[model samples]
Target: MPTLRRTLGLLAIPALALATALPATATAATAAHADTASSRTVLPDAAAAGWLARQLVDGDHFESVFNGTAYPDQGLTIDAVLAFAASRSSDEAAAKATAWLAKPEILSGYLGDGTTEAYAGATAKLLLAVEVRGANPASFGGVDLPSRLRSLQTTEGRFSDRSQWGDYSNAFGQSLALIALHRTPGDAPTAAVDFLANSQCADGGFPLSFGQPTCAGDPDATALAVQALAATGRTAKANTGLDWLAAHQNADGGFAAAGATTSNANTTGLATQALLSGGRFGTGLKGWSRLVKFQQGCSADPAVRGAVAYDATGFNAASGTRATAQAVLGLAGTPLSTLSAAGARPDSPTLACPAPATR
Candidate 1:
């Protein structure tokens, strides 16, 4: 999947070695939110994560197909890493995916070689992923991911793409940049936080793109922005964004992208996590309830069971990967800023279906 970003915007770990490698802030943050998943059993979360793990090629990476050719999909792979960490299941898959991403060639392609302009969103996201897996971002793939991302920041404080392709970095990029940097040495800079906080639309939500003539709220952008703003201690801004999300929640408890009336698993997953981050547990659970309905449960074909579909229409291969990757975060009820794989299981666990009742 190219991600909703391509359509609209854009778009791992160990144990003792991990523990020693992780920053104190990351360790502490992980500890504080460790119980976030306790409010619900989430047997479905585990199964969904399990099914997601199986979709990775070679138990490590995912591929994006174009026409008849397949290319390594580093972006989607990172999404899987986050989902695995959030669910606290499929630890091995998350670690393996992390390692795969840390490869020199792969890392270079996604983040860009110095000859090519570095991507703010990709760098920030990868930094967060490596950190979440408890790996050192400074030394990952023999490059300093955090430092690299910092270098992309503008004088005005936005973490922008230094790209020949034009700066496609959006609110999602800014949010990831803030969140990833929050775990690093000095935390996100004041200017960067202010830049994002100030960009909020009048509707009490964030826009997908910056520098637009008129700001319009986008569900996916607003959700990710809320997490970053909350992590950075911009409580007022975060709460306002949450208010916009709450206002947009459909009667079915799911959320749709900006300007769309139909609810989708991707937006619901993100908005639910935002709600949880804002401490709106009841509202978050409502989003969760709607999100799970998009999942293919026991009634689905064996290959697709536990996979989340993009919409109520049900599961299809095209949208399955992205939907499942994003949805698991909400289903597991873990906010992205504090997500880690510290105590996750090494194996993917299948759904446990109960026996049919006898007449």
Candidate 2:
């Protein structure tokens, strides 16, 4: 068994993987109608978290059913757990989801079967998630996740996957590794920090894939890197990454992926949290507004109301789960590295749009 490090319920979402727009001058009429349509007793964050909790399979986890086969979606489930923690709502649902992730059968598949292969990113992400839930990662499912992740570190300090197939770890995995290690009693190795810092593209953003012929900065990767480096006391490095992200923000205050001009909730959500962590308050608030625009209000089906859409096309069952899970972080103004579920509500609340006033 490895040395157990217990972080107090400060859970975070992994690199699950966003839009833009103004309400005042650009579209005053649309803004007023949106406000009236979204009149709710519950806060948007709480309502969004509530809708997310209700989507869990068995009120605990999510399933990726493919061709009639139901496979446990531990990654997506962890995203929900972190989102619940960030919003400080749906404590019961978060706890249940966390518990489900700790099951030996479920844990094995996600972190790998232990004997055959181990996923560096999944291990790091799970470590971070369980710690946020206030659980002991060392003792989770009878495996030491932190220790397991440590074993996968490369000579270059990047955490690589251990598999017969190939090494699939990337910048996202490296960021998660640094973050999870930072929360523990031990500091992330200096070598690991150096490796991450050295990987920054000339554009000041981090790339989704490492060692490409040419470095291409990705918004999602850059956001996670900012949070990780900042959490580890690398403020200057983190700020440079933030600068890159800021440079890429759309006119509507949301972000788009690299080479894509359209803003979406998933990227914007991650970037919003990074902005807050990096002290870019004005930009972060703008990101929040963009995320709000992606949310489905009461006019949509009740089941999907409060759920965020991926882009302007509106919410669909396939993409809504991932979109909402990521968006809640921004909607709640909760940064991933410091998210906690303490003092959260046990129940998920519904959006209550008041009846339209008759003219």
Q: How accurate is candidate 2 locally (lDDT)?
A: 0.81
TM-score of 1: 0.87
Using all chains and alpha carbons, the TM-scores for the candidates as numbered come to 0.87, 0.89
> What stretches of model 1 exceed 4 Å from their correct place?
1-42, 354-359
Give the per-residue lDDT of model 1 (tens digit) for 1-359: 11211211110112224434556578542432221222113455677889999999999999998999999999999999999887778999998999999888999899998456788899989999998999988899899888898898899999888878888888999999999999999799999999999999998989999999999999999999999999999999999999999999999899998889999999999998789757887788788767666777555577987788898776889989999999987877677777888998899977544456799
- How far out, in Å, is residue 5 in model 1? 28
101-191 per-residue lDDT for model 2 (tens digits): 8888999888887666999999989898887888888899899988898888889888998888888899899999899888888768778
Clashes of 1: 4
Overall lDDT per candidate, in order of appearance: 0.82, 0.81
